[model samples]
Target: MSEPRFVVVRNDEEQYSIWSADRELPPGWHDAGFTGTRAECLAHVDEVWTDMRPRSVREAAR
Candidate 1:
């Protein structure tokens, strides 16, 4: 069987990354609930990670 192409992950800083779904996630990261090809996952992040700033920073700005 072929491996998954990509997966979306995020860290405490709320930054997003497109990781190889065939590998293990590193520390301080969790699945962002998205899975697809690298381009697809990155497109998902592009649609979702709109604020561009960390949650904390956004909250502080308010």
Candidate 2:
């Protein structure tokens, strides 16, 4: 049996999360183009999503 597949996703706020690669993405979220096992996806998010702040919050601070 194959392990569950996950895809990295990002919202308008630029926050990152993982979702089932085979399922429809939630509203306001888009695929970040990376797919793999849950751990792999999380690692990718961890690497890329260095800042935890949302887009608006980061922008406002600028």
Candidate 3:
């Protein structure tokens, strides 16, 4: 069997996570236009999602 593929997804609050490429996405989340292996997906998230805080929290702070 082939290894599982993953897609990078982001929610309204700007949180990042990986989802199965073959499965339907959950509510309130959309694909970030990137697909790859689990590690690659995570690395993408790590590179982009530098702020761990939710969008609302970040906005409120600013």
Best by lDDT: 2
Residue pairs in candidate 1 whose N, alpha carbon or C atoms collide under 3 angstroms: none
How high is the lDDT of residue 30 in model 3? 98
Ranking by TM-score: 2, 3, 1
Q: lDDT by residue for model 1 over 1-62, one digit each (tens)? A: 85469999999989998899889999999999999987899899999998889878988999
lDDT of 2: 0.97
- Between candidates 1 and 2, name the one with more favorable TM-score: 2
Best by TM-score: 2
* Tens-digit lDDT track of model 2 for 1-62: 99999999999999999999899999999999999999999999999999999999999999
Local distance difference test values of all predictions, in order = 0.90, 0.97, 0.96
Model 3 residue runs over 4 Å out of place are none
Q: Which pairs of residues have clashing backbones in candidate 2?
A: none
Scanning candidate 2 in windows of ten residues, the lowest lDDT window is 42-51
Off by over 4 Å in 2: none
Which scores greater on lDDT, model 1 or model 3?
3
lDDT, residue 28, model 3: 94
> Following a full C-alpha superposition, what root-mean-square deviation does model 2 have from the true structure?
0.5
Ranking the candidates on lDDT from highest down gives 2, 3, 1
